[model samples]
Target: MSASLQKQNIVSNFRQISSNKLILAVSCYLVLILNYPFLAKTFSAIVNSADYNVLFLISVPVLFICVFNIIQSMIAIGGFLKPVLIAMVVISSIIAYATLNYGTVFDFAMVQNVVESDSAEAFSYVNLTAIVFILMFGVVPALFIALAKIKKQSILTACINRSKVIGLCIIIVGLIGFSYFANYASVGRNNRDLVHYITPFKLFDASYKYATRHFFSPPREFLELDSTPFLKSSNGNPRVTVVLLGETARAQNFSLNGYEKDTNRFTKDLEIVSFLNISSCGTATAVSVPCMFSRLSKSEYDKQIANSQQNALDVAHLAGVDVLWIDNNNGSCKGVCNRISHIEISPDSQSKYCDGEYCLDEILLTELDKKLKNITHKDTLIVMHMMGSHGPTYYRRYPTNKRIFEPDCPRSDIQNCTNEELVNSYDNTISYTDFVVSQVISRLLQLDESTGSQSTMLYVSDHGESLGEKGVYLHGLPYAFAPAEQTHVPLLFWQDPENSSFSLDCLQNQAQLIASHDNFFDTLLGVLSVQSKLYQKHNDLIAKCKGDSRIAFKQGYGIQTNEETK
Candidate 1:
């Protein structure tokens, strides 16, 4: 054959390969932008925002086009285009379903929940609508890619095409980087939520970080606090402190804290002091539960550091106080109860309130007499972890008979329900929580009367929940941007009048004070009559009320402590 004929053959092969690559890239782009509604909404918002100029509006789409092309080209070179594309589609679809249904942002903590969630929590997301949505948008496109035909190319042709694809991808990525650098300050300011909306990439990136941190990273060595003197109360009565560690119970819905609904009907009637303004350490159980019991404040609290150090429970146990942890929530006490005696209420445990899915908070009180009998110590500390108003299945948290709020949202997919209905369902859970808490207080009162023990109860929620507020649902947003609904939690206190030295009027006055999880560690230390170097008098709300207000309240991540008390 002549040189002209050979050149013509090469040109034909190049055209065919280029066409296939273009088709694959375009297919990926279309599937992603079309199926992932959140991504499209985010892009639209970015373009329409005041910060977006004509250049940015054009560059953003072109940049993503480049990204898809790079993906397509790389897969083509490896001859795995079909399988890779299908896998991407399926994963992206599942993520899209979660984002759309739950109004979740796929941030680092949210991805962590996905990784650490139990089978029950994971299955809670499965429903007919979500399944059908995934089938239609995710699987159908994947099937099309799986069934698509591709032509084999010569090795020489493949090499040439791959080189071109690489060069083009480099140019496009460079343009994106340069554009971002040009408007780095403004882009950085506005793009906080932008990364969250990016499909597939954000999900995988977050998952990778979580996996690396929790699994791949070296195990951190546990650290014990320095030995210090633990002075018990001089009073003749034995101290019995009950700490109710609540889950997802926001103060916004608690009637005792001035909510419109009577969610705290049972607790409001009692002579307990309810702190009007108390913020959580973190917006999730994994962070707040541990942080509340640690010496560190929210800003100073690192998960690894918090996990390594001995928490309040450990300190109490070392101080010769009998520590008992009763868990109704499925989560372990996050190492806070490791040294203490822990009783996890199994589903098999017979109770009027327990079902296979979730047990009523009241179920935690069942057989408590037997558990208390086991502790032989003179001074005892009991921590009950309650599953309080944990959503998006708030209705399942309480018994059917206790559904006082009318027209409650019955669906587990809370975003689909009306806001009023959602609030009703949530309020019902709160009411049930009130009843459970009242029962526990009554039990404590009885125990105190019968045994002549100096009984005290403290209730503090781990974090708050977001019920379709500004299209954000559930908890675990980064504390920096998290709304008050996710951080402002309820803190309640009850002390046996006969066995306590603190004045109830002074406690009530301190109830209106601005406080947070920073105060929890020292406050608990003060309540348990444990005098140690670890305890900060300034950080102790109870101690501060008793005329030790020398230390100023330092503002931290979740709560503003500088505000004057009402």
Candidate 2:
């Protein structure tokens, strides 16, 4: 044969091979692009660390790929594989980028954060870099798949192919299970966060769990409380108390709590008691806010029970204390303010401070005098929910003019910023919170002078934030594995000169005492002088603050105590 004829034959053979294996090639490429970063990280950790054996290093990837292929094959059965695969690719890309950027794990709690976030909060994460990266790696492949002409197979052939894939996956998983069960257990015990890095599967698993827990779950029944005690003048003046619920404000950043930074410049000089050791019930608003107002202790608390039971606000309202809840934060009061006179400062409301997205914490104090004047009751309990230091957009929480810390991180995606910049930005938010709290106290003091009313204010954060400490950021980790940054929150107490219910000297002395959100309900009840049957005197921080409370699950499972603060 001639050399030219032989070359032509070889070229034809190569073209035939490519045509025959086009779908398989595309699938393999899709899997590689989608899972490359995750696989690289997993393998790199296994290689660098002596903890994992060679077998695990090999089997983990193999099993993961097998399972992935099985999922793809199954999804392919209904001719919907392209769309599903595209969605998975995009989702996985976003998750992978986030994991890499923030050094976070995609667990149930993280999924819950995503689920609970509003559209604006969600959109803040959409950065140019992440979008470009996704477009290059994820969207391009998805576009290719979308544009490709997939060959329609017979129903029987498709079923057979799916069955074969499933059978292969089962066999591979079974082999892994039988051969390395002990190794798997040991690795899982040591490296639980590793499972969260398994690309598309982790995203799917988290979504399923969130949907099951949030959407498919049965509605919790509301628990009603008995009639509350009617408030009468204990002294010569009417009782007016303001409870300031702060968000994402950690104790570690407060100068009053011995932090080096001047974050609490406004409140540091005020006659306020700052608790040095204070833990939150949960690391998220959905849990902590509701739990803080519940009668049950953290250990005894049940989400169902807590949600159903009448909260501290309910008791105060029934007790004839004019209860009003003013919120600058977007989060709900978790039904704690349901029956009371509640008003949210709409982001859309005309205000010099508001930008139609989020108003400053100071906006909650907008109509302070008017709100106070309209209340016809002698004793009033006002709850002000401030949008204090909520992140990963710490800069947005405070006004630009309030940026005391220089060179603050202006971006919402905190991970992209340097640690120092992130802290500076976060500290500015805390400083602004200090300013807001001081303004609130000043308002109360002014009210006291004008109306001869005795006033007091209590400021406590819903949860603390993690500013890139130990590879964690923006809080909301499960309480068991969360660091102090996510759990240790700030608690401040202030009262007017005329108010003498609790001695400041004694309260200041008690500031060093350990406390948690479990004390909030009873303490506030005591402050309002509401003698309710549900109020536990032992849990009241002001009445008798002595016991070490355990931070437990809402399901009554004891986890740890204030000792974990160390």
Each candidate's number of clashing pairs is 0, 1
TM-score of each: 0.88, 0.87
Over 1-566, each residue of candidate 1 has an lDDT whose tens digit, in order, gives 99999999887766554435644554455445543554466556667667667766556666666776676566644556666677777787887777666656667877765665677777776777888888987888777666555557787887787778778777987977786755535664665766676677677788888888888889888888846647565556677788888889999888888888888888776677899899998888878888899988888987778888888888888888888899888746776787778988765567767777667887777746665665477888888899888887888888888999989988877777888899999999889888888988888788878888778889999999998887778888777788999999999988765455565566778888999999999999888888777888888898855433212211111223334443
Residue 544 displacement in candidate 2 (angstroms): 3.2
User: Candidate 1, which segments miss by more than 4 Å at Cα?
Assistant: 1-52, 71-80, 176-185, 373-375, 546-566
Candidate 1 residue pairs in backbone clash: none
lDDT of all predictions: 0.76, 0.76
Number of colliding residue pairs in model 2: 1
What 10-residue stretch in candidate 1 is worst by lDDT?
Answer: 550-559
lDDT of 2: 0.76
Candidate 2 lDDT over residue span 317-418, tens digit each: 888888888887774675667778898787887998888888888888775667777657788888898889888778898887899998889987787788
Name the lDDT of candidate 1: 0.76
